[model samples]
Each structure stands twice: as C-alpha cells, then as structure tokens.
Target chain A: MTINAEDLHKVAHLARLSIEPEATERYTQALSSILSLVDEMQAVPTDGVQPMAHPMDATQRLRIDEVTETNQRETLQRLAPATEKGLYLVPRVVE
Target chain B: MQWEAVIGLEVHVQLATQSKIFSGSSIAFGAEPNTQANVIDLGMPGVLPVLNEKAVEMAIKFGLAVHAEIPERSVFERKNYFYPDLPKGYQTSQMAEPIVGLGYLDIPLEDGGIKRVRIHHAHLEEDAGKSLHEDFHGMTGVDLNRAGTPLLEIVSEPDMNSAREAVAYLKAIHAIVTYLGISDGNMAEGSLRCDANVSVRPKGQEKLGTRCEIKNVNSFRFVEKAINHEIQRQIELIEDGGRVIQQTRLYDPDLDETRAMRSKEEANDYRYFPCPDLLPVELDEAYIQHLKETLPELPEQKRQRFTEQLGLSAYDAGVLSSSRALAEYFDRVVELSGDAKLAANWVTGELSAQLNREGIEIEQAPVAPEQLAGLLKRLQDDTINGKAAKQVFAALWAGEGHTADEIIEAKGLKQVTDTGAIEAVIDEVLAANPAQVEQYRAAEPEKRGKMVGFFVGQVMKASKGTANPQAVNQLLAKKLEG
Candidate 1:
C-alpha cells in the first residue's frame, strides 16, 4: 500500500496538474499514507454488507423538463479569459 | 488465411427532452453559442444538478422496447477526464451500475436471417459542448449549447461478424429509438452517433484479437467503412509480423481511414467513481409498467402487422415500417383511402422516390397524407388514370391545386370511360390510317392481335390520353374486326 514518487508523478500527469520536482517526494509520502489508510479500511470484514453510494438514504430529486434559462452569452463570456462571437475561446484542442 | 472481423457498437442517441439532462437549459439544436447554457451546464460554483424526469422516462421507454432489465436503483459516476469542451473536467456517467441492463436486440442480417445481438447495457449521460475546430485566431471555439444535452449510450457485445451485420444492427437501433419516440434519430444533426470497436482474428479462433475503438463515426455508412478499414489494418499487421496494439482511433471520413488519436493513444485512464452531487435514482415498478403499457408499437410488431393484417409483402412492409414517420404516414393513408396494398405501393414507390429526389424527410414532405389519400381515392373510383394521377400529384406537390378533383377539372385530365367517345376516336383512327388498316386486314389473325396496339395508341392519343385503356382495347378490337 505504498505509493512511490514515480507513481505520484504519473498520477499528477494524468490529472493534468504540475508539481515541482522537489515536491514529488513529499507528495509521494502523503499519497502513501492515504493508501495505507485505505488498506486499513479494506481489512475490515464486512461480508454480505451491501455497498452504499450515499449515506443519506435518499434518492435523486427530479426536475420537470422546461426551459428555465435565457440568453446569457454576454454575461457568461465576461467570466471567461477570452471569447468571440458568443463562443468561449480556449487553447487549440484536437481529437 | 481468412480473417474474420468481430465488431461491437456503442451507440449514443440524444434523448428528445425539452431540457438538459442535469440542468434546466434548453437542448434545442442550432442555437446561438452559450445562449442555451445555464449556470448548471456551465459548471458554475454553488450550482447543483437535478435530473430531468423526461430523460429517465425516455431511458425506461427504450429499455422496455429492447427488452432490457430496468434496475430499480441506478447510480451515476463521474468519469474523470480533461478536455476543453468539458468545463467540469469530468463527465457524469454510469459505470458499474447502469439504468438499463442485459437487453437483447433482434437485428435482421443481410443473409435473410435474424441475429440476436446481446446488449451489454445502456446508460444515460450528459453530453459535452461542441469544440469548433475552425481557426479562431489559433484557438478553439467552444459552444455550450449542447453541453448538458441528455444522451443514452447503448453498448452491445461483440456478436457482429461483418460490416453488413454491423450496419444492420445500427439500423435496428435507429428504428427502435425512433419508434419509441425517445430520440429524433437524426444522424446529420448529431442526435444519433456511434463508436465502433473493431478487431480481426484468424478463422475459428476462440481468443479475440486486440481491439481498437474508432470514435466519431457519425454516419451509418462511415461505421461500416471504419470497421472494415480497421479490420484490414489489423489483419495486414498480423500478417507482417506486427502485433496489433489496442488504442483509440479517429475515423476520417474524407480519407476513409482510421488513425490513432494523437495524445491519448498510449493509454487512457478515466478513474470513474460514484458522483457525490447526484444521488442514486430509484424507480418503482408502477412507473416502469406504465411506460411499458403506453409504449408505441415497435418496428418489429408494426412490420408483422403490415404483412399479416394488411396483406403487404414483407419487402413492402419493411420499407413502410423502416421509420416511424413513414409508417404513420402509410397508416393514415390506408385509413383515409381504405386500401392497404395501394397505399403501400404509393408510399414505398412514388412518395419515397420523390422524397429521395428532394432530399426531404417524410415529416417535411410537401404533400400531406390526406392529400395523397385524396389522389388515391380519385384513382380508386376511376376518376383519373394512373398517368393522370401522377400529373395531379406533381401539381399538388407544386401547390398548383388543393385537391385531386380540382386539379383534374383545371388540367382536363379526367379519364374518358364512356364507350361512345372512345368509339368516335376509334373510327377516326381507322379512317386516317387506311394503309395500315389494309395491311392489318391482309395480316394473319394472330399477327392482328399485336397490330391492335397501334390503333389503341392512336385512339388514346386522339383523346388526349383521356381514353380508358381497357375500353380502348375492347373498342379497337371490335372495329378492326368489323
């Protein structure tokens, strides 16, 4: 249940987060402790216990289908870094 | 060595709900960018998402139509990914537990047989925004209008063997979704799309080859082409001593080839976990049973009824019932005209041809069902011949007149069934063509039977194509003999 520095670096890369090279060891130690806690939690025997998604014991609330939003392109575009022609502009992304 | 392609499809159809899946934003197409996007869709802070009821109902309807199991409780999970179109940086989808499960669809194969494709499961998810690749000052433009639109992702097992079966299976999905009225099924509008998983293995091999998933196959034809190309690529690679690598590929319709996606081809890990914002959706049996009861007649049942009750040929029935709009059009025409056979012929023949020519859907056809039935009524009562009916149909399509009777009166296209009028034209034809008449008399009786066609044409021509063909035949025979 130990996470090495390389594993932490890979995890950061996948999450698109940048961490300093010197900070990798500290983050790895922190992640390893978190994993050990998970290992401890999994050690408990709970056979036949149904896994639950939420502790509230409630269901999702439903909304009737309706158009409750209006044209707020100008207002929303003001929050973005860049915009043109009512579109949110971002760095070039291709798939 | 013969290699067989094993194909599976993950079809994503947009539910025709008024609002978004988890937001109250409008899901209308072709809207101005960001206009339909609300706070919830924009992933704004302090905003919570509530499930739209109509989306759940649509999922249930599709599940029942496909004979899928409706799990009383279904959970939504967050699929962690990074993309500009996804403002939330994670898409809320279903993972270990989906709403609909274990369905089977009976897709008709090209070899005149049915193949039962096992449905792995179908899940509901929110769509991402559109990333306009057009140059925006060396950047990409994002439109959030479609961000929260509801999509039902139907996943199938690896049961299809060839491109033909793949297309047939996709078509079956299209028909069922349209029939259930859950999706608009407009591929061009991005309402219906699919991702194809393709692999090729040696013949009789039990183990599967490494599969590559081809994304962005937006059309049915492209699905077939992409899968075939991927299959060929894998088989050729194996033959050349290269191992096939599992990856995600993009289908380039312009080049008709599948290329590996640029950045994420090495590996993709979407760490999925239950979404904390949305709770599990619990459905009762009563709601599911109500949907099953009120479900519209699906394509299979309609096709069967058309053949068994309406006495339509299987081919004709299939053509009519291929789409909901076309089938309902045929049904209304049959009801109004009271002739299923004739209605099937017109709907599958002339109307289909015209719609294809105009590149218009049946819902947008210029001539309504009542208008077509009115024209067929004139045809039924001998008010107009088949040729004249076409003329009336054209005129009606061109908005020349309202009804068939009006067009017949205006264009003088009524059939002349009266024996007296036909006989007069027959006399004139025989007198004007004396040289031919003499030759007809000198000819043998057996040869004379074919010779009468010339006189029939002349009589009908002299009557301006108004002479009834059967009456023209009889009168020409008697006068030529006498």
Candidate 2:
C-alpha cells in the first residue's frame, strides 16, 4: 500500500534510470500518494461491474505477409553514432 | 539422495513467413546488418505494428495439429526488457491469452512406447537481432536482419523427467512444425531454438522443488547434455548442504558444465502489459475450419499408415515420415515403382547416405523421386544388379543421363542374366584358374564352401561386374561341388 525508498530504487534500476540519493524520498512519497489514490478508487468500485480490456473491443486487422520495405540503410545509419561494415556498433554485450 | 529431475522445454520456431511479423521489412537471414531494419522495427516514434495474417494462420495450424484449443480471442502483450539487440525496450509477445492453448504431443520413446507430454501454450512473437562480438573490437556489431521475424514460442508443462524424454519431446515438436510447412525447423540457422527448465527433488516428494532455467541451448545434442548437467548440479548442490538458487544458467559445451549467468539472475522481472496499438485478434469457426482443411496428413498419421498399410517397420516408418519433403518423396517413389520395400530401402539407405554425404536435404538432392523410382524399377526387374544400380545412381547424380535405362544402356551396366553367356564365362574362369580349382577341390567340405568365393569373384570380374552375383554364387557352388 506504500512505496519505500528501497522499492523506489529497485524500480528505478529496472527502468535503467539512475536516481539521485536526495530525490529518493521525494519520488517515494509521490508514488505512495498515487497508490493511495488508486486505493480510494478500488474501494469505490461497484460489485457487479465487468472489467473491460479495451474500450472499443474491436478485433485487430491483419496484413497479408509480404516484403514491402526496401533498403534505407544509408538514410537510417546517418542517425546512428557509429557504424562499420554495414553494421550498427554499440557497447559490447556478451550473452 | 535418489533425486529425480523434472524438465520442460520451451521451443521457439521461426514461422516461415515472407516478411516481419508486424512490419513489412524482409525477415530473410544473412543480409547486410541494417538493411532490413525499417522505421517501425527500429522503434521510431508514433509507429504502430500491424499483425501478419500468415503468422496467425500458422499459429492456428500448429494448434490444430496438436489438438490444442484455438482461442476465439488472443491478445499480444509487451514484455519489458533491456537488451542492445532489442531496439525496442519491450518485446511484443503473448502472455496471458496465447493463440494456441492446452496441447499435447505424443513422443515416441526408446522402448517402442508412446509418452504424452503436456503443452502449456504456444504464442506468436517477434525475434530480436543478433550481436556479433568477435569482429567488433570491443564494440558489439548489431545485425537487425533477424529482427521482427515471427517466432512461435511453445511452452510445455513439466512432464518429462529426463534429458532423453526432453529430447524426444523437442523432436516431436520439430517434426510437427516441419510437417505443417509452417517452419523450416533448421537449428543451425537458428530457426528452431530451445530453452529448458529443470529441477530436482527426492524420489517420493509430492511438492515440486525450485527450478533453474537453462537458456538458449540451440542444438539437440546440447539440449540433452545441458539438462543432464543441470540435473547433476542441482542434485549435488542439495546434497552438499546448500539450497539451489533459482536462476538462469548457461551451458558451456566445451567444459560440459552449467554456471549461473550473473547478469540474467537478478533481471527476471518482466512486467508484461497489453499493447494498446494492437487489438485482440478474434478468429471465428469458419476461419479455423479453413485452416484445418489445408492441413496435410501429420507425421503421426503418416507413420501409422507407413507401418500398418505399407508394412514397414516402426523405425523405417518414423524415419521416412519425419519430414514432409522426405515423406512425399518416398510416397511418390513407391507410387511409381510399385514396390514399397525396395522404395523404403533406397530412400532410407543409398539416397539418404548420398544426401547426408553432400550435406543437403532430401528435397534438394540432385536426383528426383521419379528418376530414383526408375532406377529402382531396374533393380526390381533384375535389369541391373545392386552393384550396377549404385553405378547407375551415381551416374544419374552426376547428370550423365536422365533416366536409369539411358544410363544403364550408355554405361553397359545391364545384368548378365543369360545362362549360356554366364556359363561361357564361368568355363573360361575355371580353365584359366586351374591352380585355384585344384586347391578348391582338395579342400575339406566346410572349407570348400568358403573356397567357392574365389571362383565367384573370378566369374564376376571376368564378366566385367555385369554378372548377377546370386546366380554366380549358385553356379559356382554347383560347379565346384561336381
């Protein structure tokens, strides 16, 4: 029901965000208040109301399988920081 | 400690669709790195992904084959993660409502029995790109050619208890996908990939033990080895007064050991949510029936027909029916040649060996099924002996002649079935090899039976390998005895 600084830190780490030590208390307090608002909404829910997955409830439209895109590497690679041998280079990751 | 391992496999079969699952870019492998990535797959802003109809149909096809429930409504969810290969921070996958549900596969066991492995579900998703580490000089090179390719991740219940059973289950999955023509099921090019969940408990324990996931074991042999090694590691950890840590482990094939992947250990929280851009896919009974009509006879059906109707052994039936291409080729050969036994022998024997030696699939072989059936007919009618048939087959593969009769005529490989002509050659061999004849005659009774091999060899050589070996053996036995 309440968010602590440790939980805030874990969530920040999962989102790949580095939060300053001084700002943890502020973020934790803000998250806890938002949860209390959700708690209030949960308390006021009607007993027989059905949960809706989507508002329209329309099915998705599918496209037939075909290759429609052409090579845009020259235009796209210009936006990257580095490239070599037609490959985009990044920080080394081993799996 | 008498530990028993509980294992399950997660297989990702790349659907053989022409384009990306959600984009129009080509999913073709081995292209220039960034050539295949379009704006949408590259995670540009405000771009929505549209589902591919063929991929959805493929998912339904697989569900029908396994007798799984094809849900009227299936939804795709976004699994949030951070990886350099994944340009989008989250992967679009199916979590709660997968397309295929509650399937079962009957795997053939080593003892000639069938074991049913329960399937949890299978879902359709897009694949990530590849990271090349070797040539990047401390920076990873990313090839997005494989990105957005359609993959069906089939999850199984914890039904198998050993590596052998797990492999069997994986093989059954491979057979079905390849049979359905939905996937190529090639492991070397990463078409079919697998991850394993393994745990160990005391023999009579009712509750399950904690499990470790062995991730991305790509090959069949490696799947067996990885599961076995993980089982051993877990058992040893429990016996050594240590509790097994639930984490992901990587199997090192060179060392034959599994070690915890520290990076992936703490990163297990995949907060999944539905993608608002894509609506739930709804399929009606009419669409499901259409796909069901397009389905071919599956591997189990073909295997049963081969053994029961064609009078083949279970092993031969299984081998012939493992792939659609192989089974279709065998069927055509049998239809043309009118001899199922001979067709089975050649297709599984010489044709398979040649295909294996050339490192090609049966569909890509140099000789066609009709051509092979023609060559087989020659052998059936004693037009060419078995040895001559091999020569004819080799010639056919070399493109020397189009049909078996043409090659047999050109190469003079026809069998010497004429009794008078064969007798003339046998008489000549007996006259020229007077010393061997005296030795064969003076030998003891049992020794003489073995000694007749020399005269048969001489007659076959004297006839330039065109003599029927069986006729030569019979004549040699009679002539040597007299």
TM-score of chain A of each: 0.92, 0.83
List runs of model 1 lying over 4 Å from the truth: B108-113, B236-243, B263-267, B439-452
Task: Name the 10 consecutive residues with the lowest summed lDDT in model 2 chain B.
Answer: B259-268
iRMSD value for model 2: 1.3
lDDT per residue (tens digit) for residues B332-375 in model 2: 99999999999999999999999999999987899999999999
Location of the lowest summed lDDT over 10 successive residues in candidate 1 chain A: A5-14
Please write out the lDDT profile of model 1 over residues B39-131, one tens digit for every residue: 888899889999999999999999998899999999999998888889998899998889999999887554446789999999999999989
Give the TM-score of chain B in candidate 2: 0.93
DockQ by candidate, in order: 0.78, 0.72
DockQ-based CAPRI category assigned to the predicted complex of candidate 2: medium
What is the number of residue pairs that collide in model 1?
A: 0
Say which candidate scores most in TM-score. 1
